[model samples]
Target: MAIGTLDAAAAYGRSLKTLAPAIGESTAATEQHAGGGNSFGSMIETMVSDAAGSLRTAEAESAKQVAGKGDMIDVVTAIGAAETALDTVVAVRDRVVSAYSEIMRMQI
Candidate 1:
């Protein structure tokens, strides 16, 4: 069966909802800590951990498929979700690096 655009969009929305709590918590912590550097570091650490978890989940689903015990649809969905999570993490890392570079080039 072919998936519709709405179905894909809903899946994306669900994934965003899953990440929303972490984002909110990180924001709150950053606000509470003000100039403390650990808040941003912890947020990035959490994101990387979440991405690693997604990749591990996808690997497990693929292994199940290889063992003939899992549905192809589930494998596909898990892989897609993992890919999206990894991409988000990489994008964030790139942005952070770019910002750091810009800061380093600024006049002190």
Candidate 2:
């Protein structure tokens, strides 16, 4: 891959690692607030939404750079990260939906 792409991936990885603890804490707090009745499906949905938001922000930054309003490397990196993040979110959504369908199809 290109250097910009690699850099973006690294940055995205770091960002996820840094944010994970906070996300987990918030998720836990949300579950506690709901008296522990929060479903895994809802938690996954929330995470996917968060990923989508991050991707949107990255795409905006990338667009600004492409318009000559920002750094080229930074812009390229951000775009790559955004695309990857969005793809991941989409994949997770697909998996979750599939799992839900399967559960519904059970004979129980």
Best model per lDDT = 1
Q: TM-scores, in order shown?
A: 0.64, 0.51
Clashes of each: 0, 0
List candidate 2 segments past 4 Å from native.
Answer: 1-42
The TM-score of predicted model 2 comes to: 0.51
lDDT of 2 by residue, 11-62 (tens): 5444544564666767665544334246553444455556666777777887
lDDT of each: 0.70, 0.62
lDDT of 1: 0.70
- Candidate 1 residue lDDT tens string, 1-108: 997433443454445445646667566544444333455544555566677789899999999999999999999999999999878877876787799999999998
